[model samples]
Target chain A: MTKLIRLRFMFAIFCLFVSHNSQAQTKEFYLTLENHVFTPSELKIPANKKVKLIIFNKDKVAEEFDSFDLNREKVLFPKRKSTIFIGPLKPGNYEYFGEYYPNSARGVIIVEVNYVN
Target chain B: MLINTVILFIKDLLPIFVLLCLVSTCITPNRVPHEKLVYVCFSSVVGIFAKFYYLPMMGELFDGMGIEVIKTLELVLVYFCLLIGCSSLLTQNMIAAHQSNLTIVGLVIFTVINASEFIIFLDSYLANSQSIRDVVAGLSIGLGICLSFSALLYFSLHWFIKKEFFTLLYVVWALFLSGQISQVVNLLQQVDIIKSSGALWDSTKLVKDSSEYGHLLKTLFGYEAGPSLEFIMLYTASLLLFIVTFFIKSSKKQHYDIDRV
Candidate 1:
């Protein structure tokens, strides 16, 4: 009974540690597309970390989020939201655009390393 | 706005137009019947509507991988069909009929590709119908440019064929087709469907890909500023495939003729 209690105690501590690590590693950000244009146009994020991007498309037509630099592309439909996970990037400026409305829907992601303790 | 539309239209449409002209000229129509053209046209209309109807559903397929995979498959299939069709044109052999059928299939696939973009553009236009003047002007200018270009290209190829420069025509077709095949490789890499070792070189400083001349060269000759090792390999292989097939088919025809005599 004593041995079983010790194992259970270790398991509980390990689960807590894993959850804390995952919470620290992943970052979430939100963006909006309206009238075939990105709301912010430019987004800043911490470099070398995974990011979850939630995009809300409020337009009447679909638009593709294409970024050659980030090597990512996703189609966003009208009146819908999309979740894209992008990650572990080096510090740089990555440009993205809507394939259909290349002239209008453009945005940039600026990734920078965070030096704060 | 009109000028921008023209440029955009040219960038999207010129490559396909060039491909059609080169394929039509290279085929010589003797072995491949003209009746296939009507079938190809009919299939194009079907392809357009099918793509329009299915595009939204296409996005969610195969866990969001359906679109890229389907597009890549279509591109590769078209490339294969084009190769076989061009090969059959080298001689009126037994394979010519079957290969012509394959070419028709290729044309249908290309129609799907072409129509997808056009429908998307139309949808955008409809949504922004308030800018009707800009849309009409832009489309007209773009159409005019494409029409003039197609006319010039057709006549030029006709002149070359008239001069019996079949080999020159073959060379151009080989180069253009090779470039096109390489684009499939790039697309495959883009979607992470194919793995590449990254680009081998960078030439963007000398000639930006967005420049007019750059666009022309790309459309005419499949130029790339940064090509990966796999891309170069695929490009060279496809180019060799075109030339080898052409020569092999021509020699076989000569052998058959000599036997008959």
Candidate 2:
């Protein structure tokens, strides 16, 4: 009976730690597009960790989010929200551009170890 | 604006011109019959119309995977048709009459892809009307470049064919096809449709893919600054498959000829 109670206590502590770790790990970032330009031309993110990116197209025209570095491309319709998951990446810079507006719309992601924490 | 527009025009149209030049050189005559040409043109127009009308619907299909999936399918189909058309020429083991139709199918699919870009560019320009003149001038220049470059390709390929450099032509053709096949891998990776093991090497500093020469090389042979392991493997595999199949078919034909003799 004593052993069973000890095991339950340990399990409860383990669950709490896991929940806290998950909450600490996921980071959210936002980007906005307007007039064929990214609001933040560059974004900084933590290396070796998955990130949730939410992009808002504030423009009247659609834009394609293309990153040859990250190997990701998605169409962002006008006045729509796009959610993308990026990384667990190595520390480096990943450049992206708006395929439709390659010249004016460009940005980079600078990934560094422990940049956020 | 004019320069930018011109560059964009060439960038968008060059693929079409290159494909046409290569395909035309693969066969004997430089021109197809008028009726067949009209049919192919009509099909391309239909493709453009279909793309414009269905863009929104296609975007939302398959939970936002519709476009990638559809484009990948179209590209794969085009590659196969090209393989059949070109391989038949090299091996002479298939019905020559049907080869023309296969090449036409490849042409139509490629036109659809290339024309969609034009449609997209036009729509963008129409949305912002200030750059109309720049766009028009740029398009004209782009057309000029395309025509000249394609003519160069046509003449060179013809010269090679005339010289009976079948081996050289076959090797180049195999590499070109492999490059195209590699693009299917790229597209699949782009949309997260497939995962790559990451880049194997970075050659961007040595040869940036966006440079003029880089673009030319890319079109002629799928060149990438940083290529993934999957890409290298796929390119080699596809090239080997084409070369081996060509030789196998040719040997079979020779054996048949010997028996008849």
Candidate 3:
């Protein structure tokens, strides 16, 4: 009886944790382009919500968040900054990378709905 | 303001329209509108997703196809043009513009300057062992990406651009012309006549010859960035021949008006 009671408590606590995480607010994402590559190389954002993307390229070379998939091409010059206002969109995985380093300059923009939403 | 809107509409619709026409012949009557609509609509919508949501870097994978931020405008324009010509629905105006008039001069210029872009697309598509399944998979993926992008862009333009016709027409014209130029350049590369121009041409590399990348590019449209002297010469000659006719026609109108309206 005591073990059963303990198990119920743990299950309740786990549920609370998950519920809390799911309801958390979202914020705009920022990416830094240093050394000719995106800082995160991979990113995930909430689906169907506007996210502001601020890209800062600090390398001497020019970098761009370009993708045939995303249909977006924006250049980020050395130490330069740019903004991409996107999303509030359908759920999907989008990939982009720098034109310079096609192989290494790659990343994912995953748009997903929160479990609760 | 309205100009912008109309411009947006044509730019958005032209591709869908063209694609529909291309696939029309092969489609059964029952499936024609519905299937084509779905294909074009899907492709356009996917284009938007691919554009803003994903980033598949170019130049690194196979090269020349990378869309640098600085090159966005040109790339978009190129996409429009390529879609226009590749589609079977090109109107008489479109063909006329490509063949002889200045209506598509902008596209023609853009295509020539950005000829390397198509090469990249070809390279990526062919980035595997030559097999039907691989080819189909690559095409499917690419089409999905392109469709998503175009759809989102179209809707946004509809909401934002609103109602302009001439601008839309012009943009469409530009797209049509540019695509043909890419096709012409690509075709030149396909025929050995361009490649066999001689050893002087061998100095530069256009597509990734011998690499899976090159094979993909070659299959898409003969993308030889670093080519022998022959390819370059032929490419320039063919482009020039096309360009000259445009000017000759324009000049003829200006100088020899035989007392007619």
Candidate 4:
């Protein structure tokens, strides 16, 4: 009985930790991919802040959003949206591209020190 | 388009080839049956098809974090399978059957994960139908490069084994597995399943992580240009786990042999 109570307590604590870590509410940004191109080609996000990036692929074919600079990769399905969290980064230009259409689908995430949200 | 296809193929398929080379160096022919190869091929095909159809829907789960979660789980499983296989290799007492089974399972899972990404690219290209020639040429070139690399690595590892550089080989194996497992940190962080941290250091100027060299290093060593603290810790822990397990099992087997002698 005591052991069971202790197990339950631990489980509750674990759940609390997970929820707390995942719930910090970061600023969200949206990018749309159409005709194998990322719109705004240059997105400016606040420097040194972790932010949510929601990318929607409006094309009929799937595209992989790959960024060596950001250390991120995601397969954006056709007409579906995908979310990736990036940054808390130093101010710089991080280039990203669609893996399947790199020549045409390219963009850069500009992290600025003076960007207003 | 042709260059992009070549890069994509290398980025996605190189890891599978590297893994095959590593495992081949570790196992003897009699230890792994011929039938297991067939099973791995069948499983990979089925797994890729399943992932291709189901992954997009899975992405919708957990508030758009499903793919990350699934990949993380798959990576963790692959790590354990490698652990068991490594242990079996180090210890004489472990049953051969278990080792072969674990190897097949690990290969199947890793192949499915890597090959499915390539399949996605191929699917898109087929849909477009405009760049079929380029795609075919790129695939042929990629296949040649991958095969050449795998052959070179396999022979080099065998040379190391012949030279009795067991410790170096063991360390390389451990680092490779750890590096693969460390990817889970990025996946979890992407979905906010784990707390995100800033990169400990940046080496993008030295070696871009998307370049051909980067893909090769990442496949062989799990090289990350801007790994976070969490990634480092996980990597070190996994490396230690593999090393410790190998040594402990090795010592036990040595003791058993001495007793029998």
Candidate 5:
């Protein structure tokens, strides 16, 4: 019985690895944080498609890129680039902000069915 | 700024409070473990300070993925410790002597992980000479909310225990750990160690993940407004693993008792 349980546990882990390696290529988008504000405060991406977000924090201090709408969060060290993958999302607006500078560093990810590039 | 600080406080600190309440109410209800509490507090302070200082240096490693990698390691350690602790508790109907040490280790690791982010935030604000008053006020309000919620949750769990609702309590505890371990997927994906997928569903209209209640639920039960397929699979698997392990150990213990009789 213990052997059976161990085998099942291994199978589950194997499935996770398969899923991880089976992903197709995703589209890429860029956003920059400068003076505590996100550039292009609105970003557009295609609906129902996975995309990568490359965020650059240009300030001298760190910032955390937080988006409750997208269920993503990552810390962006100053002058360093960070990456986040989001969405095969429904067409709508998803808001994001800098956790450290929430009042000033805010942006929205606008997913559109007809958005190009 | 005050509101932001308050929100940040809740986001970073609520998990620690919830974990403390869960441990106290579920694991050791009758007597307060003052020594364990002191150890947790001391270790958390030391861990947070060490991380705050070394984090910037760590970020410079792994091509800037160092922090994520380190945080993932810390989380993984917490997960294993929890499993061992839970297994022991289930088999013995109490924490075995040495297993109590593992439980304390898990609590210390968890407290450190949850508190380090807030410490970093506070340090950054203080370094920039940001409004101390705002930070203080926000912290006070955040503390009050966390204490009140934790107190309510503690009493509720105690009531459940008195009512002999052990199954429900165990299920909730398992869910909490699974929810936490599932976060490892998100962290790994953030650092590109694991592939990220599209969310399985969206429930933002039902509960905005940014709202106060959303944060509360997220901390308490690992609630996500939108969860990816990977997240769901991992969550389910971990939850089942915990439940199965507990039951298996429980049955073996029962057999041993019968043999002794």
Candidate 6:
């Protein structure tokens, strides 16, 4: 009877830990759009999760979200939030730049994944 | 434990190991390095050309001219080139003295590894899709070509008696490592060697051959450029992983005094 109770307590602890981990490892994000130069100059995602980027175009003119690093391209209208899906990726840093304003729409997705050596 | 792991790994690649044995049975190490070098050069040109130019043309010609047999033949040749790539790239320092057919084994394994990469890496892109079936079908069909190419390479490299498989494999691997395959594939696709249904275009994921590290990825292992961040990240890790595998294999060879002994 005591052993059974101990097992139950352990199971409860495991469940709690799993639940906490799920919540704790919330998908982190860092997104920015350059107004003077490109649309989204910088983008970041947690490595290997389905990345949903909501890039807001703050510039007056239409801008394209482009990056060699991320392999995504989209047109972001001024004052509109556009989303680009990026991941479930392996770990590595990639560089992306705005195609419309190559001079300005530059950013990097510093995908920091755990235990990726 | 170590011995078991080694045995299991060999068992896993039993097919290539047997093929290597069979190849060595009918041959002895040749004394003609000069002739082998020429073939290596030939392997490089032929392999690279086949990968870049011939593949897409065959794909297009199959579609346009409806010559399925020719297309199949071309795919076979691509595999041959893959074997050739591996054969050529191996320096003399990585083989066991008892290993008379190191070239063939290396090339086949290399092609297998190459084919595996094409299969495994695409999963990262497909896993997240709402429609798993569609992503699977797309990835399979595209990568099926790679498998066919690798298998064909296995056959051609193994069966070709006069041709040293290692030299050929080395050259082809070099060309492949140069990132020329993707560019050639891209250019060929642009010219309609293979036509995308453009259904994949619907996905925002970009698999271009011309991104920053795109060429690097491509040359190393046929990684397409402009892939979604997911694809890029996965590919980079994979590339690193493969490089590590190569290094490990080399170190193991060194430990055994396989070549220098």
- Candidate 4 lDDT at B160 equals 84
| Top DockQ model | 4
Residue-wise lDDT of candidate 5 within A1-117, one digit each (tens)?
999999999999767554354235767799999998999899999998777788888988888889877777887777888877776678999899989888899999999999976
**Chain A TM-score of each model, in the order shown?**
0.76, 0.77, 0.69, 0.81, 0.83, 0.63
> Candidate 4: which stretches are off by over 4 Å?
A1-24, B92-95
- TM per candidate comes to 0.79, 0.85, 0.33, 0.92, 0.87, 0.27
- Give the per-residue lDDT digits (tens) of candidate 2, residues B133-160: 8778878888898899999988998898
Q: Which stretches of candidate 5 lie over 4 Å from their true place?
A: A1-28, A46-50, A87-91, A112-117, B29-36, B88-94, B128-130
Best by the TM-score measure: 4
Could you give the CAPRI-style class of model 6? incorrect
Q: Tens digit of lDDT per residue, candidate 6, span B1-261?
A: 222222222222332333333233223234223454355445544554444334324323433322233423333444444333233124444333334234433344333433332222233224445646655564455345435644665566565434645444433344343332223222222222332111122222454444334433443355552322323333344345435545665576577676557
- The CA lDDT at B97 in model 5 is 54
- The CA lDDT at B198 in model 5 is 73
Model 3 agreement with the true structure over B1-261: per-residue lDDT tens digits: 122222222322334333332223212123323443455445444544444323334322222223332243444455444443422122212233342222132233343333233233333324434543644554455456446655655454444323433234334333333433333322222211122122233312443343445433433334444444443444454445434544554465555455445
On residues B1-261, what C-alpha lDDT tens digit does candidate 1 reach at each position?
456556657866777687778767666346557787888888888888888788767856765556666777787898888788766545645455677788788777876776566666667666776866886788898888878888899989988878878677777877776876677665554433455354577787877566787778777877877676777888898988887898788998899899999
Tens-digit per-residue lDDT, A3-117, candidate 1: 9999999998645322123434557788899988897998888877766677888998877776655545666777877656565567889888876678888999888896232
What is the lDDT, from 0 to 100, of the residue B148 in candidate 1?
88
Docking class of 1: incorrect
lDDT of residue A94 for candidate 1: 81
Task: Please identify model 1 stretches exceeding 4 Å from their true place.
Answer: A1-31, A44-56, A66-75, A80-91, A99-104, A111-117, B28-31, B92-95
User: What DockQ does model 5 achieve?
Assistant: 0.40
User: Share of real interface contacts recovered by each model?
Assistant: 0.15, 0.02, 0.00, 0.56, 0.38, 0.00
The reply for model 2, stretches above 4 Å from the true place, is: A1-29, A49-54, A71-75, A81-88, B28-34, B92-95
